[model samples]
Target: MTTKLLIGLDGQSSGDRALSFAENLAKLIGTAELLVVYVIEWSPYSFQTPEENAERHKRREEEISTAMERVVTPALARLEAAGIKAQGMVRHGNVADSLDSIAAKQNASQIIVGRSTETGLSKRIFGSSTANLVMGANVPVTVVN
Candidate 1:
């Protein structure tokens, strides 16, 4: 059976590393399907009134979708160039929860994510999403540095 891989991309340098890692893993494992997911966290403080908030959210969602497309387009192209089967998904929500949900929904054989540089005091003060996902993911998570 071919393995279905779900890779969470955060639009960071580390995410590019994860993509490379996934590509290598796919090559090694053979016949793997890659699902690349990017999450955009929507902030509620971007508007004043409820109506304005809704509009702002809608605009931001579109912007985020476009940004994700821009980011993933090249990655997907690269994967295809490498003869790897892949798809792209852009979601809006908390990174950890969104990743967990996507991985579960996709029935991913493996989940790949990048390790954030936020550690020590910073990590403690503001919990790292990568760390949270590692702990909360239902499937085995492969964290790339």
Candidate 2:
């Protein structure tokens, strides 16, 4: 059976590196499919009142969809041009959880993620999402710096 790869893209340089790494791996394992996912981290305090929060959440979802259109749509087009069948998905939740859910839902054999560029105390103070996925995912996870 062909291996399936899921790549977590955060619109950063590290994310680009992860995509390139996944592409190379895909080439080595022919017939594999690629799924690119972006998670929109949702904040609960987006509004003052419950009704306002609902409205704000709806607006934020639309904004996230628009942002994905700007980034993922073109990126997928480029991938298709390079002869890779690619699909993009957006989810709202904790980054690591969203990635794991996608991987499970797609039955992904492998997951590619980018190591956080943050270092030193910052990395320590603010835990890395990639680190969480590396520890949490059920399938094999490859982290690219």
lDDT of each: 0.85, 0.82
lDDT of 2 at 137: 88
Model number with the top lDDT: 1
Task: Write one digit per residue (lDDT tens) for candidate 2, span 1-145.
Answer: 7677998888888888888898878888878889988887765555487687669768877968885897577668767877887889887778888899899989999889888655688469757788888888899999997
CA error at residue 40 for candidate 1, angstroms: 0.5
Clashing pairs in 1: none
Against the hidden true structure, what lDDT does model 2 obtain?
Answer: 0.82
Model 1, backbone clash pairs (residues 3+ apart or across chains), number: 0
CA RMSD (A), model 2: 2.5
lDDT of 1 by residue, 33-114 (tens): 9998888875445548778766976887787778667777778998999999999988778888898998888888878988
